[model samples]
Target: MRLLSREIKLCSVLVFLFLFSLKVLAQPPAHDPSKIMRDGDRYWTFKTELGIGAISASNNDFSDWQSEPSVFGDTWPSWINTYVPDFAGHFWAPACIFLNGKYYLYYSCSTMGSHVSAIGLATSPSLNNPDWTDQGMVVYSDGNNTATVSNAIDPAIFKDDDGKAWMTYGSWFGGISIVELDTLTGKTVGEKTTLVGGNHQDIEASFLLKHDDYYYLFVNRGLCCRGVESTYYIQVGRASSVTGPYDGWRTFLQTNGRYIGPGHIGYNEGRLTYHVYDRDDDGTAKMMNTTLDWSDGWPVAVEVTQDPPGELLPDGTYRIQSFDSTKIVGVANNSPYEGANVEILDFSDDNINGTSWVINNVNLHQYQIAPKNYINLGLDVYNCVGDDDANIGLWSYWGGQCQKWIFVDMGNKNYQIRSALSNKPIQVNGTFESGTNIVQMSNNSNDTTQLFTLVLLELEDTTYNQYPQVVSYSSQQSGNPASNIIDGNNSDGYRWSAENFPQYVVIDYGDTLSISGTKIWTYQNRAYQYTVEFDTDIDFSDPYIVDRRTNTSAGQPITDNFEPVAARYARLTVTGAYDYTGPWVSITEFEIIEEEIVGADELTLNDNTKIYPNPVVDVLNIQLPAELSSGADLAIYNMMGQLVFRKTGLKGNIELMNLSNLKKGIYSLIITNNKTFVTKRFVKY
Candidate 1:
């Protein structure tokens, strides 16, 4: 199962729509977009006005960005347009959040030059499940029409270190005001208090950051929203409390080069993500990011380094969890049937019983999910329908297109699973209910029910019959010692080499077993030639040369397969080198392979049989006097009688067996499972 999630396709469509609207209206969506909110490392910029398009960036880098599908429909959720006719339906200065499995987007809506604006809220559980519902207006300015009580637009949510949340919003009409927020629902909980005010000429965009013992208030001052002519710049002030008559209102960041209107700052980690009107490009707003250099307790913006998007798992089984609740997503015992439902639960006794999922990659980080135990079962579309709200279920795998899924990574390790067949998302039918069945639904915004996390599991081990024991080297160089090769460390610093040509290393396997191949890793330098040989005797009296390398050197691990040979000892001898220093042999890792046939060895088959080529190199001829039995077996064993190779079904009078797959060694051949028997001895030389 693929452990990767990102909805690049959905974002592309959203960007196209935004660009299309820009063409029709002949105007940009929002002027100088506001604060950047990040979930884990994923970043977004919600444009001000109407549809409030949220564009995306990677590694918090806004360079050449992405746009989420626009919330189109007359540019605003239809539910609120009736309440505020003069509201302009323009969603602006949006502040986003993921709290309790829901995304609370607090935004501003107002007409041209009107302090009579409203800060409305929208809620979504999954970013990929774009079902953003308006939570109605939070708090808008209703006081005297003067700058003192000005409450118009520009909203910012400040979450503090103590878990308390507050909001600061307003434009030039009234300065900035702070209000406590209801923790359960991100809306105004009590009356507001004024923090700072000025003549409606130079103030707006309040961003709060809790650093050290101070709450730093950042705001944009002067005329904004005039495209390349906008003169807005950011300034900052700090207080020990959220509401305050603060100090140090100095320039935070200003227009540079082709950048203008540098405001609406959001601080994460040590960097600040914001936007600016560009005189370059198309004279539209572009996202800009930077870290900060601090001096005398104030800050200066420095250049930033962006990171690439995250990667998928290296390929393995993993347990899927609900990112919102930390619960495991698994098939309920009763739900393993075709029409059964899937659930996310809080407890588990056995992970492999049903929790393990096999990830079959479809493409581009998308995968088909199946249970490890129920190997043929997959997440499927139930009773298949092409309309809205189709059902989801687990069923016997028939390789249907509906079984494919893609994960969209919501920041903070959360993922939304979308079907490759329907292009819809899967979400728990309800809230964090322990055993809710997952259903397919359309995405509008963030919803907790649709999120999941893929976690890794330990791998099972395999057993080997024989392995290399003692290693003897002919000679070694001073710095490149022979012992380094067998140390089991392939790091650059550890390796082995022979100082002179005609150098060799002898490896002894404690007992004789059929050796099939050897794997080797060499140093970076390409200058040596070598050959591998095996023999039953230590001195290699009649050594069988297994493989050879003439004059080239390559770095990666190389595997050379040969005819299976029973050898207690094997040797690698270097014959030549081209290094300027001298002829030297270097190796990082060397592995010997033992070939074993599982249930392939049988000594007898019904009736008479004759075998030719006592010592074979490529093909051995087997002759049968009459027709053979259905289950007739052919197996070869080494001198030690260990089954090395075998095949089922024997027929025809003259049957040829390819001996090229076996290592050169003395061996016994057997044919027959029951009824009758045939046995003989042969050697692959």
Candidate 2:
């Protein structure tokens, strides 16, 4: 009878184990919705609680959305210390870009009206599920020098055709500045250059776009974030070169009402245009223009104008036959007049020929009623670049060298305006106050000097039939010829190539071996699978049997440690790879070293004990020491710290009841038994 009872007991235990395994597999996986955005396509939005002031998207539209973290019930990272606890007093003006298959997000932190702000970088593999790796303080503003605010904000990155990287940024402090960047090392290569000055209404938030042959400079003018009194608006100028003397000879201005602000420009498909900025009366929430058009070299707010084709006159000019205008409601057009009238004009001696035009009675300058009646010649206004001592004057004529600017459309509201003379554009210099003088200079093309902003203007009847001209500059190869190898060179397999890595190498071993030393060697113009052989004989055929590494494309030597291996013939094999013309695995000499071996099992945990309720249905009893007092408390935490259970006044044991409501998973328990606190990890089955 005793033997039969034992068999029955073992069977019952087996049955319970089977049921528990089934329950564990039945639960669904957790869902993470934090990275999803409203736009269903190639866009995403993630909430960052670094400072909690404002949240701006990588898309560069800065009108609406309070973007505060506290309002969204988000908290800052726990690692932040008490010194700058409010996270440097709020994060504002963020920028992001994708480089080498990683997403780099840059942000600014500082208080209002202070140049103590700093720019930081965080990296992730994907916009969703972004494991933000914080790269602290790439640049900081100087607190001293009242005349020049050193606040470093608004970072923009541009990669030239030659693979060289540049960053442009700046605001209120000094004007805009640019710095050449070493993308591989995340550092600046040379001294920074002051591109544009803060003079002539150049304020916060600047962007650059390369269109055709010009680098267009876009900047925010007037006041921003001032409730209903915000004078926020955008202005533009261009140059034929990256750095320049960006002439505002063809500057476009807009006016609606108290609703006047900057417009966001972007390129859909291959068309270059702008998005109208729409903000609520409170200036908190903002929207965008619904419709898009590009006939006038400027985008109108949600309205489309269609004109019929006409024949050219004897004077080599075409007349605008007819046009229709419509107002985009809810899209705040501050114009007192509800509708705009269109007309075509023929200027006899003007170089401007074969262009459509629309005349508006709106005043551009505060002094003039209608000086020259704001002409939208349908030609992009390119900023200019000239020498510091060069006469960078703006003229109305189409001839002089200073009047030339290159217009490039850099997809999303970003542009690059280059100068025809110096092949650069006009850039903002120190981050000084508004009305600081703007200057023409070389193309630093870095984010610090690139300016981005919005512009609000009425559509005019002027449309140039001829597109702006652009001059192409040849891309040149750089670096020492002996040190650097081109892509197709078969001399060195490890030479720099554009191929990306599939997976990173990881080290694993069954037993603790002294990893005192290891080294890898490669031959010229060939690839090899170099690895440290240990224990058994090296087998190159079996991928899993041998630990191996491929040559790096950076053309650098690699060596590591693998010690105390009682084996001979430490050889490297030429595995399958590209550019393998000869035996690439070459070893001049191999050395063996004797070292101490440490085992991972030698590690231990002190004063900590974990418990578990193996087939528990409801209550769980935690065994404690007899020295525990009645006032002792026991706190229980789930995997996510939802506080599933808690108790006080424990004697020799703690009884946790009413646990039938709990789910099956891992849990952490903290028991304070008579001043001897113990943290225990357990599982509820």
TM-score of each: 0.39, 0.35
lDDT measured at residue 488 in model 1 versus the true structure, 0 to 100: 66
Regions more than 4 Å wrong, model 2: 1-41, 45-89, 146-150, 199-202, 249-253, 263-280, 289-685
Model 2 agreement with the true structure over 37-137: per-residue lDDT tens digits: 22222333222233322232333222222232321133433333222333433455555556777766665555444455566666667554446677666
Best prediction by lDDT: 1
Report clashes for each candidate as comma-separated counts. Answer: 32, 110
lDDT by residue (202-305, candidate 1, tens digit) is 46788888766777888876445554445567888888878886775566776543455676776664556666655434345655555666676776666432
At residue 319, candidate 2 shows an lDDT of 26
lDDT of 2 at 112: 46
Task: Output the lDDT of residue 620, model 2.
Answer: 70
